[model samples]
Target: MKSYHLIKKKKNYNHKFLNTTFCDKDKIRQAFPFTALIGQTNMKLALILNVIDPRIGGVMSMGDRGTGKSTVVRSLVDLLPEIQVVNEDPFNSHPNNFDLMSQNVKELKKKGDKIYTNFIKTPMVDLPLGATEDRVCGTIDIEKALLDGTKAFEPGLLAKANRGILYVDEVNLLDDHLVDILLDSAAGGWNTVEREGVSIVHPARFILIGSGNPEEGELRPQLLDRFGMHVRIKTIKDPISRVKIVERRSQFDRFASNFLIEYQYLQDFLKNRIINARGSLKEIKIDYQYKVNIAELCSNLNIDGLRGDIVTNRAVKAFVALNSRKSVIDKDIFTVISLSLIHRLKKNPLESIDSNQNIIKTFKSIFGYS
Candidate 1:
């Protein structure tokens, strides 16, 4: 009966489609499929665009608890396309991109050595609340270096997260110092650990995704501004959508394998779409006028720095690429401008306007959104 229903439900669905089991039976319970996540479109777009172009910086998702922030972020483990990296490399070094390769791997490549490469799921690292700096930034074995004259360094979350995603839940509750460290590594694209004259530097580039409940606490504007995009997730209030979300979760919990099998097609389509977007992101062009409009939008909003303008441009390009379009359109700018600039606007406690509304109004006025 199950097989009959699976076959008859979607005419285009073929059992042989997607040979690889997207959700392994054993690990099926580990994460929910990304395609199955419903609502929270802004959060999903921000996350997807970051994957499409890591140079868009990272995403800051602030919303109510139980809004699927953590679940959606973790589900990215399955949604993301595989990345090719040097096999067994601690930093997840890219096979040919020297900028993303570790020094050791780069040296081996320079020596004309055969570098073994493997395709692995893009990593999604969870930064625990109680994690220490050393654990997050890696520690160097100074004693070993002093006695054996060899530098022995241990890689940390930042190293493992290279070329992947680093997710911090309840980010507002995390220590400010640690947040600073994360922002620094995220902005610089490299992490350096030094101990007693011993030092090691490695690529730490990753999509830094941080989520928190606004009711818990607000992140400092300085730290928040560093994020490339910010999205606010609200609990689903519509009766039908709420019921659908609940039913889907219950079905996923009860029939993990069948549920996964059912969603595999959508997952495959989204993963491939993301892969294509990444490939064509560089080809998606933005006109000079659009660039000026982006800058003008930021300027009119009184955004603190150029980061808003830069991120807005990058995000629009990613959105265009995600849709397989070669040129950004007015709708693309209208879609991405708020996510890229809303959090950067200076707070006006005395002002009556809502931040989101204010940004949208300014965007429509400047971009002629009508």
Candidate 2:
């Protein structure tokens, strides 16, 4: 068995073992398996739900350093189902969906040209902290357009991230303007760039994943609420669990090939679940009463906007689909309601109640939990 070493042998106990590099599908197999992660169940659940249904918007994870936040996100790459894209298209244009294809590809298809496509690993694009607006949103080359009599548009991170995941580490530290741009594109599923009075538009649909430490600086409530789900991750306090995590990391480091093989079955199982869930999402049903209860729960919590209710519904359905179920159950809502509604609550610095606990309490009151 061939080995895939993600980290150097030179030991730094405190360093993050997994590097969050965007690579080809073959290299993605070397990542730490998503199923092998030790803890942070909420974070994992949120990520999986988003994967099942990208319309759940995206997930924001805030936690302590070295809590495997980035590792978890990158590991998700291994489970991502490959997508068919037009050959040589920077936007990763979908083969059949005109809405997802670039303008040139659309014209080619309209002209009865055979649009060549190949299946490739779904993209996982990282937005660097130092990236400029043009780099992220792409730029239009006015000089080329003037000389060649064409719209010379350059694709950016958002273009590459179409039909994929866009992850930003330390997102709280990112520029507010850039953060606004990201959120806007995420919500609208399109990014439009204007340069020198020339404009270009492309599909920017992707699951926007952002992770950060709360201590660094919090995202403005308005911005945070835009994310469909928020998970709070804490460092593991249990001594035994900590030991298990360390042992697993050490084993993988020493015997990378064997470790991957050990978890190969679980990885495949998860990948298949994701693919099946996506295909069956339209078949999953949620009861009308559950929607009412969800609305009531959000109302009692004083969550701003209908986004909370909408995200909660989508997340619960995605959770059901992930379990290979045909309908939503009360317990399914319980599993995801907190993730969807907690961040939408109005900040009350004087309030002593924990946000998660508050949501749970409200849920029990409205939904009749013991």
- What lDDT does the true structure give each of the candidates? 0.90, 0.91
Backbone clashes in model 1, listed as residue pairs = none
lDDT of 1 by residue, 1-370 (tens): 9998877866444443434453354656668988898898998889999999999999999998888899888888887888899988999999889889999999999899999998998898999999999999999988889999988889999999999999999999999999999999999999999888788999999999999999999999999999999998888899999999999999999988889889899989998899999999889889999999888888889988799988998999999999999998889998998899889989989989999899889888987768
Model 2, residue 186: displacement in angstroms?
1.1
**Clash statistics: count for each candidate:** 0, 0
**Prediction 1 global C-alpha lDDT:** 0.90
Candidate 1 segments whose C-alpha is farther than 4 A from its true place: 1-27
Candidate 2 lDDT, 1-370, residue by residue in tens? 1232433333333243333322232343577888999988999999999999998999999999989999999989989999999999999999899889888899998999998999999999999999999999999999998889789888999999999999999999999999999999999989999877888999999999999999999999999999999999999999999999999988877776778889999999999999999999999888899999998998899887899999999999899999999988889999999999888988899999998889888888888876
What lDDT score is found at residue 179 in candidate 1? 98
Q: How far is candidate 2 from the true structure (C-alpha RMSD, Å)?
A: 7.3
RMSD of each: 7.7, 7.3
Model 1: lDDT of residue 272: 88
Candidate 1 structure, TM-score to reference: 0.92
